[model samples]
Target: MTGPRGRVFRTVSELGIHYRRSPACGVGSRSPRKGPRAGDRLPDLPRGLQARSSGPGWHLLVSGPPELWPDERIALVLRGRDDLVGVHRLGGESPWPDVVQGLVRSDGCLGFVARGADLEGLRAYLERWLPAQHG
Candidate 1:
């Protein structure tokens, strides 16, 4: 399977391209493939995140506060872990700059978040507030 047919992302600027991985269509990984093996890109969503999507509009139901994930970053997250992802919230001091009182806007937007006491609380916030749009 190694050939020019495969997609390859080389630089930061080219991250937007569809080269690294492909999409998966399911609730979770079917058979749980082997280590570092080629298989469906999107992994199974941890029970935590799967609960959030029950309501509406792109709710990031992970184990942390993905409170403000921009559209593009979401794309990045979706491209791979279209199922369940373990997201972490960056606080008072991280690489991203604060865009809102409690949210930070990173160069990418796979997941955006708010400040919370712990990872669990942050996950709750993301499930509570994710944007919805026309895919």
Candidate 2:
């Protein structure tokens, strides 16, 4: 799909095994009874990850680095997939539990939180994230 600047983006898919096309604006198509189709919104970020506004604007935070927190491996694996919308590196090494990197959907969409850390924050964010995106 073409974005605001005429940049093209690929649709989301399951490891390239199946693909879900994005709508014109990347907001997704509306469903008859369900409201927005499943393909309309970005899928949930893997567990233990949070995107939020930081001093620098937006940062992707993780519980820890992959070598420390097993959950951090999710981002590493996702970075290798072809079905992604966009990928960006953190650009520098940070100590354990610091903000790491960001992940976006097929529409170049990454989520943000006001403030969050660790699993507890992730859980809380999902509570709001799911309804805001899916509902």
Candidate 3:
């Protein structure tokens, strides 16, 4: 419904289809955009997975299957959850994010990301990755 960033944003999950622009509309290339051209970001660099009603309820990108493990490093955007345990708030309306810097990696070991609104759920997940003390 809005074009605020280079990344045209929309939520698609079967139960019919919703898009940022009309299904027939097209997003122009960066050449039409402003500023020095360093090229657009690699598509799906900040990937996400969500629960849907129909279509592909669970979508995975070309990042190869994500680690999908607890406390794993990620670039995420959650919307809050009452049933989730360790989820947290990370991203927001800013297309080029400025909130959480933890998503960036110096080593590139980071793979995929998740989006949810369950802060407590994420906390519980991080706890699982904690090291154990053997006797």
How would you encode candidate 2's per-residue C-alpha lDDT over 21-110 as one tens digit per residue? 532221112112321122333223342222322123223333323454354544343332323222233222322224332323333233
Tens digits of per-residue lDDT for model 1, 10-126: 223233332123221111212112211111121222323223233322333222234554445555534433333333333322322332112211212222333322234333333
Q: What's the candidate order when arranged by decreasing TM-score?
A: 2, 3, 1
In candidate 1, residue 121 scores what lDDT?
33
Cα lDDT listed for each candidate: 0.29, 0.30, 0.24
Please give the range of 10 consecutive residues that has the lowest summed lDDT in model 1.
Answer: 35-44
Between 1 and 3, whose TM-score is larger?
A: 3
- Which structure is stronger by lDDT: 2 or 3? 2
**lDDT of candidate 3 vs native?**
0.24
Regions of model 3 farther than 4 Å from truth? 1-107, 131-135
Give per-residue lDDT, candidate 3, residue 1: 38
lDDT for 82 in candidate 2 is 22
Global fold similarity of model 3 (TM-score): 0.19
Better of 2 and 3 by TM-score: 2
lDDT, residue 122, model 1: 32
Q: List the candidate 2 regions with Cα displacement exceeding 4 Å.
A: 1-64, 72-98, 101-106, 113-117, 131-135
- Candidate 3 lDDT trough over 10 residues, lowest sum: 101-110
Clashing pairs in 2: 28-40, 52-113
Candidate that would win on lDDT: 2
